[model samples]
Target: MLLMLLGTLGVVMSAAGWLSYRAGLQEAGEMFDARLVQSTRVLVSLVDEPLSELNAYPGEPIVLRGWHGEAQGVGEALAFDDGHAYENKLAFQVWDTKQRLLLRSDSAPTTPLAVAEPGFSDVVIEGARWRTFTLRSSNGRWFQSAELADIRQELATDIAGGTLLPLLLALPLMALVIWWSVALATRSLRGLSMEIGQRHPERLVPLDPADVPREAQGLVSAINGLLQRLDVALARERNFVADAAHELRTPISALKVHADNARHAIDEQDRVQSQELLGISIERVERLASQLLSLSRAESLGGARAHSRLDLDALVRTEMEELRPLAERKNQEIQLTLEGAQLWGDEFALGLLVRNLIENALRYTPAGGVIEVRTSSTGTHAVLTVEDSGPGIPEDERERVFDRFYRRLGGGSDGSGLGLAIAAEAVTAHGGRIHLGGAARLGGLVARVELPLDT
Candidate 1:
């Protein structure tokens, strides 16, 4: 903005200076012309020859027959006492209508004056410019007057120089004024920076718009909007931590009581039953703790984690290997059918996603049922499939499966039901989508995850 102002000021100042200089030159020219005309009139009245005699001879020297018809010698010049001494200094010559040289001023050039039509004329004599004027007298004599052209040129130069000097001098002052205005305009921005710098790290309060510049109001409003969102997010995290701790305490306490009872039992049969009950209670507590941690991690992962290229086929195989023992304990087998496919995702989050899906399938499948994992790439998407030979979820309950702690009706499993929810959250964090349906090959649940091939 300052540069633009300076450019505009320069154009205006240059134009104004040029116009003022032109006007000054023109006025000086007009004043010089008026003085030249006045001098010509005074010189014309001094010729004293008759109209007929003046026109008779065309190229002869008519010796000055003075005002009393006396023979005046060449040095005995007629002195017209016009108070202006500069006019006396002017070179002039007089001629008759017949073109005879009647009289000449002592200052006139030695060469005879060139005859021209009566008016203003320019002539070069001795390599210098001269302004000349010719006037015909009532007695048929011709009066010619000339002034040096250098005088008018000098006057014009002086007038233009005088007018332009002040403007040139004021240019620095104008620049200073522009600088001060710009400094005042940007003062609000400096104040805002100082205010922000002094703020505490925990203080997320909105800035005052009243003190901000109108042009920067939108920026301040956007900052305030971001602060409001952060405040809400912090508040939500606090509530989630409090609720999760409160919910887990009860199961943990139950597990502790059952373990203490199992340790005190005496008889073999009673001890076996007590041990089994304690084992189940402990498993329940473990499931609760795992679910709470997964849910908390999922909520926090929202686009904050860095992602990298991962081999989906290798990841699925690893997850299947880890779950193979659990499947064997139930008289079930885990199978993997994967293609060499790569995906971009957070490694830890994708591992959590695959682990939860496989665990969900294992917990719901019957003793003799099998769980299969598969990974393949299609066009720009990487796909992962986990299928189990178990009762499939109904179409209506499929959407609800991703809700935290939402267990299915008639589902027989000592699980926290948060596995699918964790899988959904992790998939979303990687810019992926998850779908649940009946598996065509296994006639059971199928969980498919599709993610963009590029990050």
Candidate 2:
């Protein structure tokens, strides 16, 4: 940014300098032309009578007296100590109507100073260019005054140089000022970087936006948002660890107690009962670990790659196939009604969501109960619903069931209390919503999921 600003400034300054030089040259040219016209008028007034008395034939030339600028007689009093070196460059001539050069200055050319046309003109005499101005007097005499072109050009160059010198000399100072301003403007960014760098890893506090320039406000806002998310994710991870430790501690203790019981059993029947208790304890630990892993995976889905487009109906049908064996073991009938629903989402996560819902229903439903899974699509949304013959959740408890490690009281089911929580996270990751209510047709619990068709 600094380089670009400097480069632009340099180009603008250079163009301005060029324009100033041209304007100076033009003004100098106008002034020199005016001098030429004034000199012609003055010489015509002085030489008109002298040329009339001269006995010259037509087209004849005669020389008149001219000044050398040396101190002589009365000219000594008029001469200045510092006279211009260009005084000798001026010349004049007088001519008759017949194109006869009757009178001319010593410095002037022997030939006519210029063409007979009246007005300013450029003429070359003896290899030297001259700026000449001519006028016709009332007595029919042609008066001409001229100056060397080199003198006028030198004056124009001096004027233009006078105008451009200071600007050229100050360019370095201007560059220094621009560099200082750019550094001062970027100081705030450096400070912000320093502030962030000095922070500890655990310090996920937001930076003060007011302390930054307005140009940096959006960047600061984005960083603050990231810090907030990091704080939330860190808090959740801590809670998950604490909850896992707490949940595992009870089952681990039970397993230890069962091991001791089996070792101290007085009879074979007592030892067999202890072994069964130990098995139950081990199953509880396994279930807890699986639920924890599922919950962790669901939470991470948001940061993973985008989900792919899939047929929701087909995925659910495949999940039902996998869960059918468990349903048959419980003597529960499973039914699927699909209508070619489609949506964008992680297939594995969606399958897990369906499995959890069905597994929950299977654990709680009585023998000979019926479970129904349905998939269909509207114009804007893809819908999935699982209805089971198990007891329905109360309206007041339905919302709370999605909370982590939450379970209904007196549910009489051996669950890790994380299935609904995992399902809720997975649905949220897919930008979908889930609802719980009594199944109108099944007369039991229903889990309904609605996801955008184009998500």
Query: What TM-score against the true fold does each predicted structure earn?
Result: 0.55, 0.72
The numbered model that scores best in lDDT is 2
In terms of TM-score, how similar is model 1 to the real structure?
0.55
**Tens digit per residue, CA lDDT, model 1, 343-391:** 7777778888999999889989999998898888898999988999999
Lowest lDDT sum, 10 consecutive residues, model 1, at 65-74
Q: What count of clashes does model 1 give? A: 0
lDDT of 2 by residue, 1-455 (tens): 76887688778767776776677667767888998888888887877876677665655466655445555333346456665334578888887887767777678887888888899999788999998999999898888988888765666566666666776687778778888987898888889999999999999999988768889999999999999999999999999999888888988999999999999999999999999999999988998898899899899786454558998878887877887887888899988898999887788788879889888888878879999889888889999899999988899999999998888898978787899999998888888899999989988899999988766
**Model 2 misplaced stretches (Cα beyond 4 Å):** 1-7, 56-83, 93-129, 134-144, 150-186, 238-294, 301-311, 339-349, 376-382, 391-397, 405-416, 438-444, 452-455
